[model samples]
Target: MAFGSVVERNVQRPLMRLISMGGAPILQQLHLEERLLRRTSDNWCIVNDGTAPPTIVMGVSGKVSELVEVEPVLRDNVPVVRRFSGGGTVIVDQGTVFVTFICNKTAVTGLQPFPRDIMSWTGQLYDYAFSHRKFGGNAQSITKDRWVHHTSFLWDYDVKNMNYLKNPKRAPEYRLARNHTDFLCRMNEYMPSRSVFTEGLIAALSEHFTIQQTGPETALSHDNDFEPSTKLLSPQDLQDIISSKESSTVQRVPGWPQS
Candidate 1:
């Protein structure tokens, strides 16, 4: 028995690394961690960028004019940021627990090279933590070899804050209405503690891959090239956003498309 255990230890290898972060501004949390995911040679990384203060992040292709109630959002001083990945808009606050699993397809044996497959894999793990409720909002980014799947687990979010967003025109088919609350499931309803939930995640992942619990050599907040999209939302951007809506409202005379 001892010899067999020794042999297993000798052959075992680390298939993933864990880097956990505390709290930070939402924009910095997403941008810096994403940059790390792109630059690192490590194939598999599990990151929890921590729950941020109140902020709304939109998908890369999202037009600020379409997804949010602009004046109310601004009146409330809520900053709107955009992420590089393609996903829907979400309001994040301290009650939101973030868990990210990113890996090259080659790192995990038999893992599919598609987003839905990857999402399914994550859903299975989160299922245990959120056993009674499926209130996780998931998003992903993929490349030929690598993919990132992250989710916002609404633990105990402020119900009132859902007012900041307007119903999107192209709402998900699963979400028949443009309503926000209808789409959310609170984490606290099932999993009482973030720590316990993460512990479950670590144990669940250990079943498939050897997960090494280690901090990154550098911190998540180390200055990076990522800048807040809201910081750059200038007067011209606002004018453009307003004009973008206005142009869509009025019928245009027949004209050739611009280059």
Candidate 2:
């Protein structure tokens, strides 16, 4: 079916809650919690900017053995987290931004299933954001399920820079950090700032979904009544998570992955 027809069927299905988070680790935790909640409630959507503290997160399908130099990351006090969703491993820092959509299967229509339609709708959202920019790349939808749509953006990224950070021996199985290719900007030469792209994306998605724009909020904080999962990793537990991948190969640490 055409993308628009599929989206229309799903748009009015229900009120899907969207939550934008601060960093990668917190995003991972929230995604897990939302998935658990979906087992009972099943009607909320969440979007998060999983950037900050500059860490590398591997998707469920991503092999930690293939993604990073784990030992160095641990030594540097960086946390390597695994997300519940299936996608390639991603290096998230202050620069990377993330968006997640969560909802129930009944909320989808026209499309054969929830996953398919979510991917289609998400593609349209990215198209709207990129259309306004001179340089833009495509949005890659990883997996489709009744619960969530997982995707990432390749902003002005440098292939050499990523290689230096992850030190992938061969070209990455997924797209490597191509200097010019960007999901939200054109050619990566003269791109808009990360804030500009994020604002544009939020505006487009709000209009497309016919939902009001809600500002950012903390997912699990002491100030908020909502309690974080006790299952959350403590500092030592996080270290164990990193150390558990003892078999993963290691590479020399570059001066700074960002610069």
Candidate 3:
């Protein structure tokens, strides 16, 4: 769509769906964001899971073989999900807070639908929520005139889970050759509570975007209208993919974390 047309449509559409995301398959979470970007015209900002079972998620452009130690990941019985966004691999488990903001290019003042611009805006926004430590990672996925830019703020994480990810051939510049534990910082170090921080964030974001609280029931309700070509990859699907790889790849897979 042309820029003018997109802006015009966005002008008429002002509601930003704030969906609560939790306890679902991490791959399913990724696919929902993909669907929202491609299939719907509504603005959405997802405040996702605070914690669930451990899972290792890789960016879409991230090569599974390069970023993951398949054996350790599988042996650990953790689901390895490849997201549709471009970002470094990370392990999601108890205490990881996921925040996503999807909007039209013109939705926010001085904001462009482009990647770098959105990322920059998000960094500032994150700073407002987490002013003490810099946000560890941010990602962008653009479609037509709308884009999804999200960040993961770890509250607390296990050092052992970081071992599932191998040193990537390509990594975020901030990583600076540091391993996972060294690279990311927990949000808990700064914020007293997840609810306190996220609630404050929602209020802060409302200043820039016309957001409205919506239950998860309204999630993908518009999806009956448009569906993407790519199917959501399940844990079993990823496990099979890893199992078929070379023996060397399988050796790195970690045993399932003891419950």
Winner by TM-score: 3
Displacement of residue 11 (Cα, Å) in model 2 is 8.4
Number of backbone collisions per candidate:
1, 5, 13
**Model 3: CA > 4 A from native:** 1-13, 128-135, 225-259
- Candidates in order have lDDT scores of 0.65, 0.47, 0.68
In Å, residue 257's CA in model 2 sits off its true spot by 25
TM-score of 1: 0.78
Candidate 2 structure quality by residue, lDDT tens digits, 1-259 = 0122223433453455556565646455444444434343434444455466665566555555556655556456665565555555555554445566655445544444444455566666554233433222112222244565655555534343343245334443333444323322422334446566566665655443555434334333323444332232234543444546553343323443321
Compute each candidate's TM-score over C-alphas: 0.78, 0.58, 0.79
Note each model's CA RMSD in angstroms.
7.7, 7.6, 6.6
**Superposing every Cα of model 3 onto the true structure, what RMSD results?**
6.6
Greater lDDT among 1 and 3 belongs to: 3
